[model samples]
Target: MTAPLILHYAPDNASLCVRLALEEMRLPYRAVLVDRAKGAQRLPAYLALNPNGLIPVLETPQGPLFETGAILLWLADTQGALMPAPHDPARAHALQWLIWLSNTLHPAQRMLFYPDQYTSGDTGALRATTRQRLITQFDLLENARYANWLDAVTPTAQACYLAPLLRWPALYGGPTDWFDLARWPRLSHFARRFEARPAARRAALAEGLGRTPFSAPTPCNPSEGSAI
Candidate 1:
């Protein structure tokens, strides 16, 4: 028998990517809602699972794992899927893109979504700068060899990571008018195709994402306070 997998997540958070991966893997797992709105993640119990107080912590029999990139890499490596073979040359390229997406692109999105975390006041410039930097990052995908990010029939970890990051600008960036997908046709098409997959479709629906999830705004509630 296999050990059960548990994913501690919050809606519309980076956890969404992990969920997509799990769905793609066709693996059975349980989801634990670390309701950010309820300050659940910051609470003592949840912090015990992930000291960083971040969402998307995967609870395995060995222990709880944190960090989105590490978790994705672990899943690919252990499951022997969603990644190229270790001896394959393409494996190196896949690793490179995954790291860049996690370290570079992911942080940029964070800055745009939660500028207050990085800046004490007047986050306008920070948000603007980060947004532009993000656009350039996507441009690399638009012009790179792996413009599709996948030669395989199904979505990979790279695609899973990219999907949410691509949706970041429209959801959190100041206004829809500021950023345009028309600027990067290749990247736009890639997103459309990835989202069309059955696994992607199921994951999106499970996460309460709409057809135009990129344009879906983050839910706001004055009564519920959450830093995450």
Candidate 2:
């Protein structure tokens, strides 16, 4: 039988999601890093596993899984917790939050923030359009803070990824930090509460990062050329 081995880039968004769940279960696994700066992820060996050349690929006895949402969901299903207790309202609720994170939250923020990182063309204009999507998603979540989406019993997987992004200054530095959490005190409160978990702390440290994930560059909107 193959041990669960995860191939990921430390600072990538999807890697964070798996790290959180892996810690929560205290599962024994190995982390093989793909340092993007050196272009390791695009190497043929890595591409053989995931032709898309994306990070956060999990190689298991069952094969490989990609994408943050699927990776976390696969973990939860194996454990049978944090995903509602079958036929419960929370089952549908948990799925909804996961879908929102997959379809809206992650993509919108990536587009707004990582445009130049991916393309040489004007990312600023695309970021402007994506920013609106992020704000709307944030507002929608705020509108229903009490909806129990963040409950420990079924803590939506969204937090496993989003909280770290919010806290990492390298990712959201400067004036934007004010807007990132100011209007979302409830969400921030929830994030703080979640981050305090032992599992969460372990996940943060497991990447062997000497500093917080926020230490990276914050790109300008794509309208301008790449930040660096």
Candidate 3:
């Protein structure tokens, strides 16, 4: 029998995206906690798997895969689900949004979460600016032509990836008063629908996310490991 994939993760981190996808696909995998409160990610042992010391590192037959987007894409392709097939015309649209989530929206959130990483001074101003940028990004996403995927009855990798991004702003980084899911009705609707899925419910339980994790997120009370 093929070895089950191993996912090194911390609760409520980007790894949650992968866990959601795994559950959606009903794949066999083991979850290993990385305790961020203990600085476990930066330790040499974890570094060997992901030199960047990121929260997630999936041990696959090919090798250890880091980066949440890459792992989600790999799972979609390998399992032949979650994303449009290679020859499908919709594949272009799917790839475009997936890359946007990884390169644009995710980094914008990171900047809001850790402004000090970008600037040594005036982190407050940095966060303030990032918050507005995130709003604009969300607005664009709300009206994107291909946004039908967000509410599809069958979950997609993009939906798995997006659900967590929608959740974090309300719970993490700086003041969340500026971030409201209801501001974008379409995205808000997507959140409510996505979180009700069996896959989402299972991932939420595993990570200690509340029942309405995506639509009405609360700070995680993970059974193990720290979210920070």
Cα TM-score per model: 0.90, 0.79, 0.98
* The candidate that achieves the highest TM-score relative to the unseen native structure: 3
- Span of ten consecutive residues with least summed lDDT in model 2: 219-228
Cα displacement (angstroms), candidate 2, residue 85, comes to: 4.2
Q: Per-residue alpha-carbon lDDT of model 2 for 1-228, expressed as tens digits? A: 247666454453467677777776677777776766577778998888788887678887788888878887877787765566567766777777777777877776666656776668877666666666667777788776435755454455656766555544335422353245556766667766776677776665554332333222233222211211
Which parts of model 1 are misplaced by more than 4 Å?
A: 146-152, 214-228
Residue lDDT tens for model 3, 1-228:
167899999999999999999999999999999989999999999999999998789999998999999999999999999999999999998999899999999999999998999999999999999999999999999988976797688899999899999999999887899988999999999999999999999999999999999999998989998899
Candidate 3, residue 135: lDDT: 96
Using lDDT as the yardstick, the better of models 2 and 3 is: 3
Highest-scoring model, lDDT: 3
- Checking candidate 3 for backbone clashes, the offending pairs are none
Order of models, best TM-score first: 3, 1, 2
lDDT of 3: 0.93
